[model samples]
Structures are given as C-alpha cells and as structure tokens.
Target: MTKNSAWTILAVIGAIVIAWFLVNVLFSLVAFVVKLILVAIVAVIVYVVMRVFVGGRDDRR
Candidate 1:
C-alpha cells in the first residue's frame, strides 16, 4: 500500500497493455496481406482459364 509500489504496479500494467495492442496490430496486418495474396492468386487462375477457353476466336476473319 505504499506510494512506490503502486506506481510500479501501474507501470507494469501499462506495459502489458501496450504490448497487447502492438501484437494485435501486427496480426491484423499479416491477415490483410494474406487476403491480398489469395485474391491475386485467384485472379491469375481466372485469367489463365479464360485465355485457354476464349483466346482463339479472333482469327477466323
């Protein structure tokens, strides 16, 4: 119940809170990057499929 002990406890709690916030932010950024990479892979697959199916119809003229 002394003054110095109270300040030390408060400092420890503050450090834990800040660390948690930083970890959450980092995970969110990683998730966003994964989503973007998945979207890009899907787009490339669709493009290749479309070219295979529709890329030969312009030479009959």
Candidate 2:
C-alpha cells in the first residue's frame, strides 16, 4: 500500500476505537444512573410502608 493509504487506514481505525470507547462509557453511565434511581424508589417505598404500619401502633397508647 502507499504511505498515504497506510496513514488513512490508521486514522480510521483510531477513530473507530475512540468511538467504541465513548459509546461504552455512555452506556455504563446510563446504567449506573438507572440503578441508583431504582434503589432510591425502593427505599422510599419501604420507608412509607413501615411508617404506615409501625407509626399507628404508637397512637393506640
């Protein structure tokens, strides 16, 4: 191959690798955020349920 062609191929490969890395990083960030939101929702639900059930017992006294 010509010298110019070799350089072009290398540039294309480098760009593809960079793009792949960026995509993976973005996907991982999205997944982490989703997990955090889910955990928060579950914690809130549990707290509400416990308060409803446990707090009423104190009023019976």
Candidate 3:
C-alpha cells in the first residue's frame, strides 16, 4: 500500500477509538443523571406520602 493510504487507515482507526471512548463517557454521564432524577422523584413521592399518612402534628414541642 502507498504511504498515504497507510496513514489514512491509521487515522481512521484512531478516530474510531476516540469516538468509542467518547460515546462510553457520554452514556455513563447520561446514566448517572437519569439515576439522580429517579432518586429525586422517589424521594418526593415518599415525602408526600409521609405528609399525607403520618401527618404533621400541631402540638407544641
């Protein structure tokens, strides 16, 4: 193969590796954000349930 063709192949491979690494990092970030949102939603639901069922007492401390 010509030197130019060999260099082109190497560049393509390097690009693919970089793209793969970036995609993995992106997915990890997305997963963490999704987990955080889910936890927040569940926490809010639990808080509402507690307020409704257990209720806050008007009694003095």
How do the predictions measure up, each by TM-score? Answer: 0.83, 0.87, 0.86
Pairing residues by index, what is the TM-score of model 3? Answer: 0.86
Candidates 2 and 3 compared: the better one by TM-score is 2
lDDT of 3 by residue, 1-58 (tens): 9999999999999999999999999999999999999999999999999998777754
On TM-score, the leading prediction is: 2
Q: What's the C-alpha lDDT at position 34 in model 1?
A: 100
Off by over 4 Å in 3: 56-61
Please give the CA lDDT of all the candidate structures. 0.97, 0.97, 0.96
TM-score of 2: 0.87
Model 2, C-alpha of 42: deviation from truth (Å): 0.7
Which of the two candidates, 2 or 3, achieves a greater lDDT against the reference? 2
Ranking by TM-score: 2, 3, 1
